[model samples]
Target: MHVENSLTHYCIPCDETVCCACVSSRHAQHQTADLVEYIKQKKIDISKHKIQIAAEHLPQLTKELEVLKQAKEVYQISADKVTSKAQERAELMKQVIDLVLDSQLSEIQKVKDRDLDTFIFRENEICFQIEDMKKIVADENGGENAESESDFNIISAEREMKQKLESFSISERSRPLPPKFIQGIDDMIPEISRLLGKVERVGEIDGGVTQRKSAAEVKVQIMNTVSCAKPGHKVTSICQTSSNDVIVAYNTQKSIDFIDRNGRKLKAKKLQFETQDITMNKKGDLFLTVNDSSLIYKMKTPGNPTQLYNGGPYKALGLCAQKNGNLAAALWKQEEGIIAIINSGGKLTETISYDRTGNKLFKKPYRICENSNGDLIVTDSALKTVTGVDPRRHRRFQYNGGTEAKNFIPIGVACDSSARIIVSNWKGNSVHLLTSDGEFFRFILSSRENVTYPHALSIDSLHRLWIAQKEKVVIVKYLK
Candidate 1:
């Protein structure tokens, strides 16, 4: 639609197909080329542009083709690898099939050999019994009214063997034997039956016969662990201090010793008398509950102590600190069974007792922690259950030593801020985790070299388990 003006000399420079007559006349000398020649030059320029565009596209097309070729080669390599692996597996399967067939044939041959042994044994035993009977009959013919005691013993032994065969037959009749196995055993049955019939025809006689059943023996392989030195005392209680040092109380020595993380002994003075269970309170105070003693001792500082709880006819097995400034203890009473609760200043705040279903807090209980909106996860060693009691005094979760539960005897209980309950079972010698609802998570297997006889457990701020054991203490970080 463009037209060249008079000032412009070339139509191409003006980008026009035609120019006005005055423009053509004024530029006649500047552009004297013919119109047909101009058209030819324009066509040449168009061809050059087309060639440039094609050259630009060629590299891109080449790059795309190279990429496709690489992808195809990679796929072919992976396919070849997979096919080779499948062929190897098929060859291994064939070898295993051949081995199985050989094993089966060998088992069949063993059965045949055992059947032949059984037939021979039965025939020899029958012949021996017949010969003994004939000897007794010959002795009677020699004018002996009473047979010798040896003859009577032989008869008694034969009778016992016959009775054993009869019992075996009776026991075997209820179930149908495999036809192949029964066919292998058929040859000995006739001779065995004939011997039994002969023994039955001998009639009843009095003889002192001793029937002995082979005792069943169970082989238990007990590998005795020899780790610690032979201390002059037994470990009465174990506790961990704030500095991660384990304190083991010995009853005979009447002392507590500092133990390293590797269960190596350290020099520490013993606290006096039968230390049964030891625990540490929030103020880093060491507390010891003496067995069969009414008083509990608290060490404000190391080697300096004072009696905290006196005037009590109870024995404490476990002690823990509540979130508040109170002490929770598992106490055994003469009249009542073991009860776990927090006794603040000799006043019971929260008491837990069991019913028929082993539910704790079934009765009305008060001050069960308003901040903690979940159940009171308590491990009962006597009842072998971990009971969960809601704040409203309702039994919400219960896991016991039933066929379904994993724990055997739960002794200690500790809960995290996230309401994950950790329980240590004395029988299992391992720690178990339970959700807030008492469902099992998994067991923490005891590291034999470091941890053994785990009796108590607590979770730290970082969710790592601080376990209390007999010989040493262990800390395990739980992974999310």
Candidate 2:
């Protein structure tokens, strides 16, 4: 019985409440010498009772620790949420205060403006009434002496009122222009002041904000035809002058005529050239390009054309004012080919030579114009294509519609007011409309009848498409 008791289970390290047979056989040669020495040295080791106690209370300790950890996490999360909410509240309050202050400031400004308007109106009225009194005094100076004195007094009062009104011009009541009154300057002052006070009172808030407002719908009216035109002559180009008169470049049976918009031909004493293309600069001057001539003629006013360059035979196709205030000309010759550049002191400024595929710039450059992006658009009739070149002369619009002339013989080209390219096809006997990016969009032709040949095209401010039929010798206007 004693030997069997010694073989029962016991923790050997504690060295307590184990029979000699258990301690001597199992724990005698253990690998942990410190545990074995502790077991041997302790007077009261808990080896026998440790397992029993841990088995009884481990589940409760585990549950209590889990509860403590969960509580700690919940508390931290709640604190963070409260901080965020407080910040949001603070921001909202700040915005509200600012809006209120701004609205109040706007109202105050409106009130001040109204007061100023009223004061000006009253002052003007008083001045006019005093003027009437002065007129009465002037008319009745030979009456009774007392009445004369009274009229003089009235005149003095009127003069004083007139002086005061003159000090404040009636133009003050006119519209206050632009950003100065965009937010009702007076109304914003109070709102901004309020925001200055309530900045931190509001809690955590996102600084990003959104505002939406409706804008006024502006109505614009346009006229399709020239409002008032000359009765008999064919007007090639019309330029409106700063003096409210249109300088018209017109053509009669014999010579090109210059006239005002009212049809009265201006006395152009110096301009004695028959020109095909005419233009006007902003300074109300004339620029005419004669057929088969290299020089561009400049008429500083309504007078005879003066040759810009006498070294002729270099046929300048088109002339336009560049952004740099220098004149740009497209000059073409068989040897020189086609080149466009700014003319500074009769010298070329920039030159571009090749297409994207390293081909020559133009076979026979006919006309050139500037597009919306300030690019020079040139029409090469021999190549049967239109090309857009940058200021640096790099080819941008290499519009190659095959080598076939029937599909792409662009003769007359003009840009409409909406930036749509209108090109008259010499071979096709039709017109092609191209988008600003040089993409072919649509065809403009009278489907009812095939016109013989469309020569030149132009677009007026009203977006009307005008085609000059050389064979017909008549200019026809078409709907857009």
Candidate 3:
């Protein structure tokens, strides 16, 4: 008996071989293509995939694997050195009890084992991924199935393999293994000696672990004041541009002056209305609010200003930019004020007018800032408090100068890189540092600094605090 041609055609949907009769009988409505033609296109696709894997994906993964291997080696070397040092110290203390020595050695060994296990597990994981990727490249090059595999089978395999390779590419972007082991035995040296009975009491690690500098550790010293603008111009707001140039907005003049680090006026832009508040966005564009209208204008340069927000009934008093490319405007209507978050196209995305309890949130919101954690920090001038609102416009907490912050009257608000909210006191002539959640941290600048009329506050890229006074700009180095 003669066998029919069963693999004359390919069913694209079912991904299988089919004869002429089967194509018409079962897969008549399905997409069918010539087996030879399908195989030809699949071969081309497989060739391109192989090139991507070899030229791009494999090389990157191989580099990452090498890095992981080197890290593992370093970890092993450090473990060996720690173990050897413990042994030498134990040998020197010949009169020490065997039980105490063993305990000390056991502690060292525990650290070594734990770190090595983590390093090895990470190393093996990278190695396995590398090998799997290599296998994919090899399979795409038709490892052993080149001769007999059907076209449908080849196409299906290539699709699945490409997905896995793409997934590997994505995983490489966020690989979690640290470049080197950071934990060390330096903290355990004294403890090890005391545990060996060399002293009557047990010793603790001098510094258990490395810690970040807290807000309390930060100290501020007034560097110097520079006359940024003209004599009669009152500094209304101050911000640092992306080019590290300080820009000061003046109330008396319809202009904003850009000053360099050495306090030289580099450029100035004349505005139509007196500048009320000015802030720099991440793109280095300036957003300014005028005293006359409710609109906010975005100025890429001095003369060319485009209206950003012109909708709400309240007049814009202060302007600030969020990290997500949204602008926060302190809008005031008579005695009540609201923090409105506007998009780039001058549309309001959210408004912070009321708290979760349906109570009004702000009395007179001015000088708005967004913290690193997405909380809006507003200086409520009327209430004499600084309030933090969540992304959902709910009140997180409020700072009313507490007992130490007498006569607070917060005016300009800014959050530093360390997530500390710095609020300038209008009447107290000092600046208060609060935690991001509005808890009172400490006074960064006290009234003792001889600061008079501290109004607008800003934190520069170097973590230096900039205070806008009457006609001068004060720069203070508050963080190292």
Candidate 4:
């Protein structure tokens, strides 16, 4: 019974050693190898697997378990610390709230007690008056000699009763009941809870994850200086027409001069009264504010100026045309001024004297302009700030040029086609660019050689900024 005859062949599919007779019978279709060779290959594979489990798999799994245990400990410690801190803060807040609640309750109770005592005292005084009247009536009802005594006593009692009644009437009519206590905790508790939740969320967030936005950058440089008005005539205000023509208002000359882009005089009109400010309407007609007068004049080319609107009590100073065919005028009533919005039909539409919060919007409005969004931009000379008013006649925002505009004294304001507000600060000797909402965007021009006292500002159809200074007008091409 040799081993080769007994179980020599190893059937790979059945994983069993078989004899030659078994291979011929049940294992005929199976792949078979010699038993000794199969055992030797399996031994080598098992040895390699054992080395991998001992050297790599087991050691790696043990290291991972140790790391997980350490992480669990760290997490537990952190959670405990956070919980302790939150509890401490909550306890402190509760103590503070309790103290405030107790103090408020004590004050309210004192008020209630005082009021109740006053009411009780008043009731006792009323009862005492009733008893005195009853005694006077009883004495008057007695017989014979009581008649004469009662007559004298009745007159005196009647006089005293009338005085008491008058005092009681006053008290009954004038005395007010105590105010009822209102619990505001119902409204405040939700807000406080929301704030606490926000605090917790903020604590969880990393401070390094926040990103900041960069400020808008703008560069402005002067293009050239051009004499747009007559020599020795002061330019009070400036505006641009649709055809790129600039209209300059001369207060001393009482005239408006239309000049081309190159400072060549194209057309000139002599106004009856001295003009303070000039603006152009949609039809290219000029609206001029008569200085020290409550009248605004509308002038067309080759036609005499006609009275556009009567400002009545307000004296028109600076004027601008709105997109809706209305006129916004900076009018001075007395010491304080207002921005008046008048319709094209010479009717006063609205007046902005005070803000929605009932605060004075302007002390002395010098220049006025309407933005593309129907907002009125005005430079308040007395306040030294540029103020914006919305179409609904509410004060939007005010800009005093912050620290960047040193010694700011805004005198003129204009809005460009891009909705950017241009303000000229005469005292500061600088021109500032602001957003439509009256935020200071940048400094467009600063006084230097040849540029002093920038008084008026206007942006033309070509986006060129025309600055009216004393004696000379500086034109700058500002790229937003």
Clashes of each: 2, 20, 0, 0
lDDT tens digits by residue: candidate 1, 1-480:
344333332343232334556355654433233456667876896787568657755886697679778877976797687678767766776687699789977898887777677667766776776776677568557845654568788798679767755643323353333326333366666754453332222211111112211111111122222133244445545555676666666455666777655456676765657776677755777877776665666786465657776525666655655544566555665434333444444444444565446644322111111113335555665556776766444667777733325647776566765566667666766666566677665554433333455665544444456565554345665533
Encode model 3's per-residue lDDT on 293-371: one tens digit a residue.
6889888854578888783588788888876688889999888888777788776655678887889999888888888
Off by over 4 Å in 3: 1-219, 404-406
lDDT of 4 by residue, 312-376 (tens): 68788998888668888888876789877778877665667887678999988999888866678
Q: Rank the candidates by TM-score, best first.
A: 3, 4, 2, 1
* Model 2 global lDDT (CA atoms, 0 to 1): 0.55
- Per-residue lDDT of candidate 2, residues 1-480 (tens digit): 456444343442242344555456765542223334545544344543456447645875687678778877976797787788767776987788799889978987887888778777777876886787677667557454553357788899679867865754446446343223346677877765564443232221111112211111111122222322344544333333434443434333225433343335564433455455565555666566665667777776645666764324577665655534556566677755556454534444444557657878777776566664556777777778888786446787756543234566776677654455767776666666666667665555532235446555555444445454442222334432
Looking at model 2, report the run of 10 residues with the lowest lDDT sum.
Answer: 211-220
Lowest lDDT block of 10, candidate 3: 201-210
Worst 10 residues of 4 by lDDT: 205-214
TM-score on alpha carbons, each prediction: 0.43, 0.44, 0.55, 0.53
Candidate 3 is scored at a TM of: 0.55
